[model samples]
Target: MLPLFPITLAAAALFAPAVAGAAEPQARALQPLMAAEVAAGAPGVTAYVDDGHRVWQGAAGVADVRTGRRLRPTDRFRAGSNTKSMVSTVVLQLVGEHRLALTDTVARRLGPVLPYANRVTVRNLLNHTSGIPDNATPPAVELFKGDPFRRWRPEELVALVADLPQEFPAGSAWNYSNTNYTLLGMMVERSTGHTLAQEVERRILRPLGLRDSSMPLHEPTPSGSFARGYSLDYDDEYNQIPETLRDVTAHDSSGYFAAGNLVTTEADLARFFRALLSGRLLSPALLAEMKTTVPTSYGPGIRYGLGLFFFDDTPCGTLIGHGGGMPGYENQFASTPDGRHQVGIMRNYEEAPDAVTEAQGTLWSKAMELACAA
Candidate 1:
């Protein structure tokens, strides 16, 4: 077993000021579970879960390993691929308002940019059925390794994968590709005559009063106090070069573009998903379309529906949310299908032990445990 960080002043800070639900006796266990995450090798972890009536926030581990600053429950972090849900929500909103159509082919909007744009439709892009090859090129990875702060344009990222062969015939099957969301971002820009960030702010953030959430674009650092992100140094082949961890808290997220560049706190994420599922965000018909899912490549019982993921077979009934991972950060979020219960989890360190799946499984089980409890 890995050495666990004791509940020092940094960890003890949470047990005092943390929110706990009076009706949720089981919710009190969240802190111990988060401590287990640190014992399992996560540098720091924060979790927030709301059961509609009560909200509980838990933190365990240091914000910085060197300085031993206690992790703030409100601290923001790179939301990574969680940005996909917001982008897709905006596009679907546009679809509902007659600004765009799901059947609209990418060629109709961006013919010159993507080689196979004609064969792919907006619906295909939203559902990851576009079969667009991923742009996570070796060169890009090398660049990330060499200079984590290197800025990138969405077009520049798209150009790198344009000439690559399609993963499969467009719309023939389901495949998770970051390239699909990249195109959606471009489409949003072309359709609205505004940047993706602007549209998201106008349509989602501002209306929901999610003051803590913002798309960082090329900005390498977040606005307020944030937990530092760390990852094990690895070579091109993902072979761990050393046991040492590198601080990647300020890594430029432009490389992720619209697909994974959103920064938000757990509260903001919960609020966004709550509003979305409670019928506040989209029309009934449109939200229904968003929930209609197909089996994903992730694993059995895990389905992908538009930008959201449906946990079909969890112990907590079924959940609807998404998971996001970047270089030095990762997050997991899930809520009941009706949005009455929700949980958002964050870990500062991206690298994991060989039992990464097991570590994640523990979190999933914990979320479900809290969700199903009294």
Candidate 2:
């Protein structure tokens, strides 16, 4: 049976606190930050910022249009690849203890189960230069869509990707493969003799006192307060897909595994990012290693370090973060160099206008400028 927290629906009501009573400037600034995506056709969005001392959160649109439930800042949503950052933290902690080496080959740990295991190393997986084919690519998509609720084992998911040809020779270049982190998840399990969820709870979540974050494997509802996810359904003509409530509980956690399978709130996510960047989660050396960059062409200047991306914006300079997308959700969390400021944003519908990313970039730039000014 699923372990459901007994918090009442009234407790969930705590999220809709007196927004009307908020200060005028904050309320005014929040309007564009929350509605920009939806104005571009996104169904809903929630955003939060942590300015080293206090937090600001705002929400727009509906969480469940079918039920007329409004979006809330406290709502929980599947964090997608943002899960990789958290998993990398646990792996680095293991590295700190000498339980594993960054250069350790997978063959030594996974044995005959993995065909090309001999070629990939722990560092390769963390930085996503593994060359391993992403299991979430093709045939696996069939399995996922056919039985969205299916619980997949790590080996099963890895085999799906392993059955495919390598994209490049190991470490020759960078390719973001879900397979890399799924294998890393297994590596964490084997090294610690505990499930990935348990290690996450023991090493990061519990220690940071993140009460609202959860690594739900097969369970649908979270233990405490959370948000409902929504998807857009389109017709033959290219138009805004009508927003429909989604059951994310059926999302195959096994497919995402360590790569992208955790649900959290904005406040908890901000806390985690702050802790990670502040040296509370990793040693200085490991954290430094985690922040170093590899080349990419996706944005102004894109680079991948261990499990996070470093974005170099003309106005904001360098910021560390990870962006994630699933069927009906998109999320981003970024922190400045000193870890004194951070921003997190989540949208319910997958298809938002290209302007959304630009707007996000603009918001980050403005937020940093304001923070630095203060």
Candidate 3:
């Protein structure tokens, strides 16, 4: 029999800090939202809400089941596509510096290596209309299966999609291709002579003082405290793999790179959303440009903004934010139009079908209702 060990609580305590100034009224009101998320079967969750002056943060469930650890507010989790917002911020900073223009074609920066580089502009890549084939397609799956732990260079990863036929004519349509941002990552390096992580740090992280956020490239799973991810069980006859548990620390950040390779805590994410909505990262004009929408087939009433998603609210009001998922992680960060109130949630297990997405939308709606009432 396998030996059983009690999970450590020290890590949990170290990561979660006491709620600085949570008010009784607000904390009681947030109970429904937390209960809904927990009923959805999430192993762990962290939520942060900022209503102008004071910030309210809460956590529920477990971060590491094997260690019997509970989720903490400060525990870091994969941000998945939330990284795009950060990347876009850096790109916009370069524009502010006059180092690169949104109109510049990628080929001007990356040269002959990228197949559609000549046709796609920097703006197209940022908005996901470049029509570049997504690197996360079958070819990328094969590469990962063969060498899940290999550290990949940006160029080598770009080359994988460089020769693939364009998904559509450049700038003619929209598609959520990871390749666009992978190329954007390379372009950032080429244009600024700095890696994506370094550029993000200098332009956004440091300026915002987001101390807990990091762009770990091929590093081990996040240090200090974090949730352990699990895959659901499957039957062999059905070609289903058994539910397995593993330390997510060994996963390669290279595969995500600029597109989805960020790790951060809920408070850090709330800060990012708040700063972005407040126009701290971009000029007012640029922020307006970033919020403009382009039609896409992904969903009815769904549109793509520059590095953000535009969703029409029902009876409440319009909201903007992004959602991301990996094998074992799902996250959402959203805020109101005026940036007065923001909600961020991260969960460890991805096994729940559409639960995370549904919970996110529900949470956003609840937040909007609460904010508008106040």
Candidate 4:
């Protein structure tokens, strides 16, 4: 999980077959477009796109700076809060099964594990209106820096900020909090007779055949053709604090848990989004509920749904999905509601200059536009 100031993975089993398109030919324009970002001094990058018929994957820069390993599209990443979307999906599945309800209060579900549980509904946790403060506090990060491999239990994550004041009254305002999803993760485990990872695997991963995607509940770092993530100081606005780079690829992932402890490749991530938006994951009514929107502090026009983000003004006609990163890796992905177009971007470093970040966003937007048109 890229740090809430310092804090804190998706989809299905239907269309997880071989690639339909030639990657290089499909990404001709996109290749150089992303290459320019690498030229602009960003770290190694990997990406994937699906335009219904064909899929394209591309990469630039080194996955391992020490060895100068070229980043590959198949490499896995520690996708941070993007894990919220999956956790929320499992919760909604439970709801569909009559095992859980959106209106069920935390107090009703977790039974007073939190002070405001009675007032915070399951919907609140999914939509970030729970008013619960985040647990990925500055101190936890400090502890992480001291011992990057320290294991964390789900309960310990919530306890970190449990005593703090509530962010707001339940269902009153919107604030992104990692703790909400952590509770939902706990709820998933308790409601199902299995761990959160097992439930996700049973429901989403295995069915979708997302071989490259995993909930590494125990692994500290990724293996295989994985890109190494690095860290640097960033200002409140997330602009780079120059000259503060640190290798941050190794760390225990339990702190992120369901909040965002996914390890997946760009193609696998894009495939899940494609299946999800194409109406392969859930019932129509539940999918609609997932896309239900509430205003977010990201900006006046920006909005969030239950574990899903609404990019209403995007190039691909209101693409809906999520993005996540922690110290070493960042990922952003979205697809049109009908799943006609999709894109997944992977980055190996954080806190670049504002221009670089904006440029990356623009290029990403263009990639989606190109993918849609292709």
List TM-scores for all candidates, in order. Answer: 0.91, 0.85, 0.85, 0.88
lDDT of 2 by residue, 196-269 (tens): 99999999899999888878887745555455554443333434433332334345466678988888887787
Highest-lDDT candidate:
1
Question: What TM-score quantifies how close candidate 2 is to the native fold?
Answer: 0.85
lDDT digits (tens) for residues 1-374 of candidate 4: 33322211000111121222434554666666566666555566666777777777777766766555666778888888778888888898899999999999988877878777789999999999999998765423643345667778888888888788898998889999998998999899988879999998998899999988889876767777677776565555545556444567777778888888888887777767777766677778898899889999899657899999887766676788899967677789888777768888877776444544665786687677766876
Residue 295, candidate 3: alpha-carbon lDDT: 85
Whole-model Cα lDDT per candidate? 0.78, 0.71, 0.70, 0.75
Best by TM-score: 1
Which residue runs does candidate 2 get wrong by more than 4 Å?
1-21, 24-26, 138-144, 233-249, 297-300, 351-373
Over the stretch 79-181, how does candidate 1's per-residue lDDT look in tens digits?
A: 8889999999999999998988999998898776777788899889999989888876543364345676777788888898888887888768888888888
Candidate 3 per-residue lDDT, tens place, 1-374, comes to 11222222212222322343455444566556655665555556666766655567777667766655777778888888999988988888788888888899988888877656788898999999998878764323432234556677777777888787888888788999887788888878988888899999888888889888899987756776776654332243323232233334356678888988888887787778778989888999888878988987787777888898876753336667887776557787777767776667676755344554476557656654554454
RMSD of every candidate to native, in Å, equals: 3.9, 5.7, 4.4, 6.5
Measured with C-alpha atoms, the lDDT of residue 205 in candidate 4 is: 90
Q: Which pairs of residues collide in model 2? A: 76-227
lDDT of 1 at 61: 72
The all-Cα superposition gives candidate 2 an RMSD in Å to the true structure of 5.7
Lowest-sum lDDT 10-residue window in model 2: 1-10
